[model samples]
Target: MEEQLFEATRAGSKRNDAGPSRGGGEMQSTTGATSLKLLLDTNAFIALEPTSTAVERGLEFGAELARLAAEGGHRLYLHEATRRDFARDHDLARRSAHLALAAKYPALSGIPKSALADLLTRLDLPAPPLSESNDAVDLEMLAAVGAAAVDYLVTDDARLRGRARRTGLAENVLPLAEAVQLLRDLSPRPLKPPPAVEHVLSYQLDPHDPIFDSLRDDYPGFDAWFAGVRRAHRPAWIIRHDDGRYAGVMLVKEETDTPYGLPGRLLKVSTLKVTDEAHGRRYGELLLKTLFNHAEHHSHDAIYVTVFERHATLVDLLTAFGFRDHGRSPVGELVLAKGRRPSVQDAALDPLKFHTTFGPPAIDTRAPFFVVPVEPRWHDVLFPDYPGQLSLLTGEHPYGNALRKAYLCNAPTRRVAPGSTLLFYRSRERSAVTVAGVVEDVHVSHLPEEVARYVGRRTVYTLEDITRLCRSARPVLTLLFRQDRLLEPAWSRGELKTAGVLNGHPQSITEVCNEEGRHWLQERLNEQR
Candidate 1:
């Protein structure tokens, strides 16, 4: 939870409270202070265009953010680069309107040329020749954050956020929604919940259902495909709008009864669609995630989809999740596929020659086992099917590329190789060892770009979240592990301590080296039989 920045007084006011020290990329906020400043990205300014359609809900939200911040006594500004980006538009009238949007908020004269040049050389960074060039504008925007010109730089672009984090300005960066939330939380006005009509619900619909016929325009061959759909094929995952209309749908086909012919354990996305109203709301991403969870329950060799080239946004989203371009279909649709390589557990967790010797040495020659701590929230996101009332992680619950993945932040204690056992110690609220898995692959990087590339489209955390988590110099560890199974009855932390399997609560990774610890865990696994 974020530390409260002030104390409410009886006189309908607040006073500055002694809160945690803010440094090293920590969010800074104060009570009754006008120090908080926010800079909007070029796209955010464009989103505020007057002629935008209601379906561009993100644009409306972006405008609302500015109004809220202004009301909350916070200044909304933009880097001078924003003006240049807006001016780049060929449409003179549109460009003028965009510039007008920028005029609403004061512009920060971008980082001084001398300072930018010197810093570029000092940091061994490239300085584009033309100051008004796109690259130069990007650098200027980044320099605004690096020089602490703004308390928070708000943007809808994830790559820009990642870039800011790479340049050691993570805390200064905030996504549009997050920035709005922070401003609202610190606002004097009481926070009001969004209308119930905005909430979308997920439900399953039969493959051959008539409701799906409405989407035939998006999926030209959907009717023919539906006719060939297996009787036992998995039902389509649907998201319904608050008005009870369909917002999005994902039709998946798995198993030997394949759609695209390439047999043996395949998951094909025959159709994925989201209505205009839900375009920027991430409903489509949720449908894709639903497919991932379904694939986890079965052995699928690959997950593939045929999307039209015109669907650029959908294609970009797919590419973010590690989907590769596999030429085109016979009918000329773009084909993308994400192959699921077998994990160590899938091969029965072979101890000998488990992995080539690139990673950390095995704890024991027998098999590596460590009690890894997991935030209860993450535990539920990673193991959603686990028994209990699992709370949704977010509106777009389980964000990122969550296909058989786990994140290790703040410098995990140990770096185990593939085939090593990870006994999940679900900490805080639910203190227990409830799930176990084998590490399939590990990617370590201090560079957010490298980490993002490694994770591809299978991360559960946004780039902003990853930056927040890995604010320190400590490298981020991205573990690609398939959860083998969950313990029927979870082993409480105290129980493990009494059995000498765990000493105290392991703040970092704690190896289960003792023979007694292995025996105890083995007995729990035996219960499954």
Candidate 2:
């Protein structure tokens, strides 16, 4: 069991993203790292605690954590904010942890609550603002890493993942499971091509550090920014650098803040430039990927960039890393957004449109109309974990009335032909970037609400928009007609995951199996097929 854990801790984070994540999309990683500074979020703590089932499985989650920290390959850290967040959100578990810790170390337990809180605070755990935003715990976790000068933080929390990326702290972010995997990569990846600067770097150096003078002119506002960062008293990483060339550098929020409320760990890459002299190697992607692993470890919400439309290709490249596309314009550039609401809804009840299917059976090929996949421009999106989500969605979400109207009736049956629009919301990990799938074949009676939007309308979806849209507006989701395009430069995980509904169904319906994940629907279709 320990062996399995040790190996997991040593594996690369790139491999952990093999499964489907957000917006019915897949994270196909091409880069990763082995040993990284590591931290854990509340969810990670829960999963690793001996009392948790994750430990009972002989996985030995906690012991492995200790081992990683002790071995130096994994720098396991915990922030006060992280612990506090855990205590607040998962009160019972945290209380249990406190009690257990007290029992394990009687002397520590005897410490007063206030003293303990102070001590824990002194221990340097991250605890951000829980009032204006719920990211206090998340930010605290990142701060712990920045304070401890650790390189990674691991957790499954969506918001944390997004936050890590935004603060230029991507290198210190990671997921619990993903961190375990990274522990295995100690051998390191062979040096790749020199990174072509993917984005520009814009930030002033900290004047407190001697090198600040050399870089101050280029970075601009070095003294003020660093002072402000220090004044915040939050855990901001001031890695005084290995070369002694830099005394201390603050790497947090120098770029973007918790995305104007789009949720999850969202970051705007304000500084992504590599030194011009290092231009020969394409290490930017590889390095960023490593940084991203660190960011994921730390639990930020999402990483974003306000790039002009002119850099479409560069944007497309980042899209693959789960760095979702946020539709906002870069300043100094003329940003244009064209929107005309074709369907209007009453302002009060605000009826969001959707569809429903009677039941299912029969149907063979998804070639004509089965599960037409989707293509969200931004691949990486995270969301908060909600209840009743473990069960594969059959129809409308039963937890809320707003969502319930879209649920599918799992029983009664029939042979659905290709082109059946089943609009069911597919949940993304960190962000609820709802993915609506269009049924191309009739296998099981898939949910129809999401289909109404995917196959029903001829509109273009910022695929991740529904997640943001659902929070404020529930549009009148309705579907009409559009010629089926089984194959057209298929790009999207929804097209593949939507098919999972039919293929993953337990009921014996049609011999038509559409289990081809993202590729299931339009995977093999011709451009005109």
Candidate 3:
């Protein structure tokens, strides 16, 4: 069995290596030749080896990593300690065969025993007994990572990850799925954006797909309920990968009477599920964006969802967007609801709080407003819905898909308060204000890594882009905002100057502090509605 597996993997490697380059290297060359060094743990190494049984058993991320390495010119190495651990296997022939297989990759030198022991002590880990070679090897790998020997240490060990978190090395450790996503984010290739959300009848779906399995387990009569929905031809919203696999699904229905004593017409989120593979990619938030946009467009009074407490991530996301806990449902599920009404009381809330509470199309008119100048290149990606663009290249960018987005600039304007109105003025060819958003937060930083962590998945800018911006030694101002409206009949440069909204062609983020200009702009927005 060992020899057969080895031969099978060798054959698979040959097949993989024979494919044409996938433009990763070419893309990198255009962008200053950035590449990552990935250090794989023993389990990650085996799972990623071509044709390995582990890859067949749902370790598909490993295959993705291999492809990325071959195409992107990334270097993948195995820690020398992994080799020693493999040699200790009880099955002599299996051990020998695996050792030979491991020899295919370059080896990362192991840390010295004394240094490893000191590092373990510093991290508050007990030294492993002499007999426990595996534990010692794990310590060595983590020590190397802590010392910044590699860009990342890829592993799936829960305990090891826990230790990493405790020792402040969590950012350097990654599970296979997240590791794959990081590489994808850092890759220079132009990726296809995730598919747009589609509205379809319930009957059009396959209820037995793995995407629905968890929903079935959570609700006893889920299948029967779905069958009824199918018969009624209930409408649903879904997102799928290019290969036709479901990334997310949302089932919603309109309720005329208050189902839970909530006022006005309500849209109940009956089911919202994002596949495990899509968890960290923010597809749930994308689906929520779709749902919120639908409700606002259709003028629904409120939205609600009943989810169990065990789904904490989903619950947290809901609450973050101003969903309030309205107590428990009949089945003991937590009922979260958000109202569409913007009350006088909402005027006092901060920018972030106001937007979260009332959602889009419900901005605080009392807040200050600013006209932010954005270049044409960035305007297209940051606000893809702006009209007249020949083509919008989203590149599977999460920031483009998200209603909540970040913009980075080094303009003189600073201290834009949260809840402040942002008029995104597309400079150059378009030269008009095309989009509007509400500020959620503001951050100023000079370090690229700090800025990266601050904006996170919210910004369309890549690390390289941020690095370039920081090269000028000016502080990068990261503005986090939720897109509120796409202005139709966008206010042009000439019109803005005539209305006193701008004194001249704006080159930076400019405040619209003139009361007459603010009033005129407000009237225009109301007229557009």
Worst 10 residues of 2 by lDDT: 1-10
Q: Rank the candidates by TM-score, best first.
A: 3, 1, 2
Please say which candidate is ahead in lDDT: 1 or 3. 3
**C-alpha TM-score for every candidate:** 0.56, 0.26, 0.71
Provide the lowest-lDDT 10-residue window in model 3: 4-13
Q: Highest TM-score, which number?
A: 3
The CA lDDT at 504 in model 3 is 84
Number of backbone-clashing residue pairs for each candidate, in the order shown: 6, 112, 2
Per-residue lDDT over 145-179 for candidate 1, one digit per residue giving the tens place of the 0 to 100 score = 65656556777676666556456554456656556
User: lDDT tens string, model 2, 242-318?
Assistant: 34333222233422444445444443343233332122122233344334433444555444555454443334334
Off by more than 4 A, model 1: 1-39, 49-58, 67-76, 84-101, 112-234, 255-263, 273-289, 308-325, 332-334, 341-385, 391-422, 426-431, 436-486, 489-500, 503-509, 513-529
Winner by lDDT? 3
Residue 457 lDDT (model 3): 28
Q: How well is each residue in 1-529 modelled by candidate 3, as lDDT tens digits?
A: 0000000000000011112322122223234444556789876887776434432432688888888776656678898878888888898877887799898888878455665666677677675646447667777787777654656788877677766765656656776776776666555557456457778888898787778988888889988898998887777888886678788998888886888899988899888998767755667777887788789778898999999977755776798688999999999999999998876776678766777788776666667888888777667667655567622233334446667677777765675977788998888777889988888767666654445444432334455665677665457666777777788878899988888899987777789988889988878765643
Runs with alpha carbons beyond 4 Å of true place in candidate 3: 1-58, 62-179, 390-398, 456-461, 523-529
